[model samples]
Target chain A: MSYFSLEYIAMITGFLLIVLGIWAILTYKNLLKIVIGFSLFDTGINIIIVSIAYVKNSTAPIIDSAVSLKDAVNKIADPVPQALVLTSIVIGLGVTALMLAYVLKLYQDKKTLDIESFTDLKW
Target chain B: MLYTISTLILSLIVLVLAVIAIIHKNITVAIIAMGTVGLFTSVIFLLLAAPDVAMTEAAIGSGLTTVIFFYVLNKIKNHDA
Candidate 1:
């Protein structure tokens, strides 16, 4: 079914994941759960970016003995998104790690995971 | 042809796990499920022919991030008691 093409499905899924992640962020009271939601949202965005660069039935953007320069142009999927996502995944890790560090500091001060408990910040 | 179908299905399953990770009441289970979400995302990246992204996701998203969560959670729990 053309309606269920590869990119379409990925696009729909990406959008759905983003919406769900946001909803979770808004609904969850726990700090860790909110971080989980943020991770999901970041991943959804990555998926959408990669899916946008997808080419139907195209091979990966790798040049080998099998593909000559001219033929490779049309046969390989775009490479930009993959490069971008590599950094995105790493940076996502950094941000998540930072968030966890904050969580630890907050819990140390308040000894609680509930978001509603923290309001003072002057240390 | 088959790869496309499989990847789409796997991504959809990831979507489900992601939702669980965010909304589940049990904090530990939800975080574990988030790791699963990352693993599946990597798999989907493989199916899409991006091995670099897939490895990065598996290492960072599935591996490191989950462990950090567990580490912090454990520390928080210990501090509470």
Candidate 2:
């Protein structure tokens, strides 16, 4: 496959974002930064899902004047991944919101955002 | 040909923004950079023939998520004062 192909480009970007997110999550001491890492990881996963559904030389899955019904089978990209990513995006949003709320509560309780300071649960 | 080039450049920009968001010390700047990454990812989704996904990402990922982060940050700041 060509290096500049759409799927490859997006997939590589997605994977790199995932790695960056993981690194941030592991190394960042701040609670907010950890949330940012989770956000990046979520975005990367969504990108990968969309890229996997990509079809070479094909338009979107939409059925309009651009794509007739008869030969639409081969002319459009996969719709399944698009649908899946849609749901994933909503779920990610919910997860991010929940994480932030928890972070807020943690900050209120400890008066600090540092992960190292929170050791009540540490064994 | 042009589409491929655009996708290449956009993806590179997104990666750069992602790194910025990761390494930045300020919570506000990191959050904004992450939002920009989402915006660019939405555009990339458009190029990938997924306009619906693109719109959703732009709205929720870039717009709503950033706003939510800022809201929490502001609340924390008020508590500090």
Candidate 3:
């Protein structure tokens, strides 16, 4: 594979992220680590989306008066992925904040952050 | 070529960190390792051409999450044992 090929690079990175995420979930007994694993998984999905939008030899999707609109369109990067990434970022921030708040509350009530200590709710 | 090698190295680093985080007896050290994994994942996001995602990963994944973990650690006693 070519060293600079965007697709190959993206695929490898995404795959690695996924594997790390799963490992995090399996190996960590901490609840915080499970959340981190989910975050890693989310990052991998976002990367895959953006990678799918990549086109070989494409330029940024900005319109320029010097270039014909049709020609510019032909070489422009996909805008959909950019928009999706923005949405995903906002959602991620919201979720992380909420999770943190919950963690604080859990610690306050239980006086412990260890997942093993929180056996009261277990079925 | 370069991208592949860099991604592989970063992945290996993340995996090692995750293992250390899991095995570490110190809760604080494990939490810090989790943040390191987040930082590495953000770099991978950048390599995947998702700058926005990378920014979010760095901010929430590393910054807010680490802070929350630390806060919980402080609130709880005997977490390291």
Candidate models: Cα lDDT each = 0.85, 0.95, 0.70
What fnat does each of the candidate structures reach? Answer: 0.69, 0.89, 0.29
Q: Candidate 2: which stretches are off by over 4 Å? A: none
Chain B vs. true chain B: TM-score for each candidate? 0.95, 0.97, 0.92
Deviation (Å) of B39 in candidate 2: 0.3
Return the top candidate by DockQ.
Answer: 2
Tens-digit lDDT track of model 3 for B1-81: 566578667767776776666567776788798789778877866655556667777887778777876776665554435
The alpha-carbon RMSD values of the candidates against the true structure, listed in the order shown, are 2.2, 0.8, 4.0
Best-fitting candidate, measured by lDDT?
2
Candidate 3: misplaced stretches above 4 Å?
Answer: A1-4, A64-68, A121-123, B1-81
Give the TM-score of chain B in candidate 2. Answer: 0.97
> For this target, which candidate reaches the highest TM-score against the unseen true structure?
2
Poorly placed runs, candidate 1 (over 4 Å): A121-123
Query: Looking at model 3 chain A, which ten-residue stretch has the lowest summed lDDT?
Result: A1-10
Q: Distance (Å) between predicted and true CA of B30, model 2?
A: 0.8
Which whole-number lDDT from 0 to 100 does residue B4 have in model 2?
83
lDDT of 1 by residue, B1-81 (tens): 687688778977998898788767889999999999989988877767677788899999999998999999888878768
Q: Candidate 1 clashing pairs?
A: none
DockQ of model 3, rounded to 2 decimals: 0.32
